[model samples]
Target: MIDVIGPWNRMHHQDTLEAMFRLRHQVFVEEMGWDLPLARNGRETDQFDTARTIYLVYRDEDGAVAGSMRLIPSVLPHVLGDVFPELCSGPVPRGPAIFESSRSCISRKARRKDPNGMIWGALTCGMIEYAMLRELDFITAVMDRRMVDMARVADWHLNPLGPERRIAGGGVVAVTMPIDTHALDTVRLQRGVPDPVLSLRFAGARAA
Candidate 1:
């Protein structure tokens, strides 16, 4: 199940949030070696993780953080806008109805259990559901080429903002993914998830 954690309910999920940070450290720092300065003490975090950020955390049967992603309002400072502006050909897209997704990762344990990538599919579905609930228009991200390819295979309507560039020893591209019923249905159909993935507890949470 996926839990949506926002400022409205952050105090109730500190342990889960910490586990998410550690999972990020394991994936982005220990495994991928991405040179993130804020990764310290077995936690991967940065300035962007603030009160305004919304987190989607996927938990396994044992309630361990299996995968997670964060959503930051595009109107605020985000990684693509503040750190990798060169990845965009023109101005970085920003608005109340737009969000930037970052720090997406799945734990090794979950990957081992999900050989067919259903966990990733669930996370993606949850994000789309949350976007739909909040009436968001677009989601932007700076993703590695491999992830971009996966998005293509999943049939996400991705609009590239700039040409792919080699960053941190890999091809990375900036893209805007349209948020609509079509995009959500495509992922659900391809992943064999016919039901909504976001936790019902916060599924109806309004945008702050």
Candidate 2:
């Protein structure tokens, strides 16, 4: 069984950051051959990493980073609005409750029978718990095509932006998932969120 937990910005987070970089390089750069030439620092990062964000990392029993992702508030640096401005035609949503999910890649070395892998589930659950604790208004994810169906399967509130499509990693479509007031009312209906304790971090008024 994998142990799921949060990494504070202090010790655990530092290690997690390194692990995330390595995983991204391994998957996005070496194995997948998407990043072209490797980076001088051996990382696959963008402006989103430095934004107002919280990272959730999954590690093995040996404490090695297994998979990871990040959460960014829409008010700040979201991939679609802040970074990938070409995709949005109008004003980006800034609901005081919106967070954009980014950098959600797992370790390529880790094998999985599923499409997105187990880390995605743990990260989503952890983000929900964290959102409740922080009183966040909403959570969002920029959905590349490959994971759009996964979002639907997971019962997340997702939709495409229409017209413009960005495909990466072998023709995956792009979309988004927004967890606003409507989503708050039905988070439990989402798959793999049975244990309410997993949502303790993002609970309270924010969850309502």
Candidate 3:
């Protein structure tokens, strides 16, 4: 199951948020060796994790956080605009209808149980579903080049914002993914998830 946590209801989901942060620390800091200052105390958080930031969390059958991703309004400070503007040859895409996706990760326990990558697919589908529900036009992200291929396999319509650059010892590129029903349906079909993933309780919350 997936949970949509936004600013308005974030206070009600403290435990879920903490689990998501711990999962991020495990995947990004301990495993990937990212030198993040906020990644202490077994929880990974950053300046971007503001009240307005929205989160999509995937919990396994045991109700443990298996995978997660964050969505920040493009108009606000984001990773591509604030930290890695050089990755984009042109101006960073910014608008009310655009959002920046970042800090996507899956927990080790989930990976061991989910050999088919259903968690990853569920997170991707949830992101697209939330975008469509919020009437977002595009979702921008700075991710490893390999993710580009994954996006293709998932049938997501992605447009590269700039050429790939060697960053943090990996090939990273900025991209903008168009949000539409076609992309959503394609991902749902590919992932074999015919039902919506976003939690109904928060899926219809007002855009932050």
Candidate 4:
């Protein structure tokens, strides 16, 4: 299950957090080789992973973390403030209309078939789940380039903020997802986008 984690649940999910960080290092550092100039320890983290960050994790039967993601509410603190102000001519978002989701990573080792797809679904679910819990409307983010490109043609509603560019070490772009808190977790017959969305539903949870 992909569990929504706040500071209240961090202690129970320490192992999951470790695995999440490890996977993040793998993808954002070793695999992508992003020399994050903003990193404190030369890691991929920006100013986003602070106390205001919301963590989402999916675990396996083997008790290892499978998927992970982090979110920053635009109404509160967010990356558009400290990181990429150039996304807009004036200033980045800090409104109730948007929530920034980031720090997404899936474990390298597979716990099931198509680990990447599983991670995407879990992360997407986590965003929807958070929106419902917090009574928000939109869950957006400055996404990686590939996701932005793929999302452009998806059934999911989107608003593009930036083109793909190499800013963070290699290059990544920014995009937004207009998440409906009422969005169903179950997969729909979607057409468009090369990477398909995850077929997922929260256990014991129904669509709002």
Winning candidate number (lDDT):
1
User: Which lDDT values do the candidates have, in the order given?
Assistant: 0.89, 0.57, 0.88, 0.60
Model 2 over residues 21-93: C-alpha lDDT tens digits?
8788777777777754435377877666662456666665577877767777677766767655545455556
Please write out the lDDT profile of model 4 over residues 69-141, one tens digit for every residue.
7877686667665667676444565676467887777656653556336556656765665665566666666
Clashing pairs in 4: 166-171
lDDT tens digits, residue span 20-139, model 1? 999999999999887898889999999999999999999889878999999999989999999999999999999999999998999998899888888888888888888888889889
Candidate 3, which segments miss by more than 4 Å at Cα? 201-204
Question: Candidate 3 clashing pairs?
Answer: none
**Predicted structure 4: lDDT:** 0.60
User: Cα-based RMSD of the predictions, in order?
Assistant: 1.4, 4.8, 1.5, 5.4
Worst 10 residues of 3 by lDDT: 199-208
Off by over 4 Å in 4: 37-46, 75-77, 162-172, 181-208
Q: In model 2, which runs have C-alpha deviations exceeding 4 angstroms?
A: 1-8, 36-38, 113-116, 168-208
Output the worst ten-in-a-row residue range by lDDT, candidate 1. 199-208
TM-score of 1: 0.95
Return the TM-score for each candidate structure: 0.95, 0.71, 0.95, 0.74
Return the lDDT, model 4, position 119: 50
Q: Considering lDDT, where higher is better, how would the candidates rank from best to worst? A: 1, 3, 4, 2
Kindly list the per-residue Cα lDDT of model 3 for residues 34-153, writing each as its tens digit. 999978999999999998999999888888888999999998999999999998989999999999999999999889988877788789888988888888889999988998888787
Model 3 scores a C-alpha lDDT of 0.88
Which is superior by TM-score, 2 or 4? 4
Off by over 4 Å in 1: 200-204
| Residue 128 accuracy (lDDT) in model 3 | 87
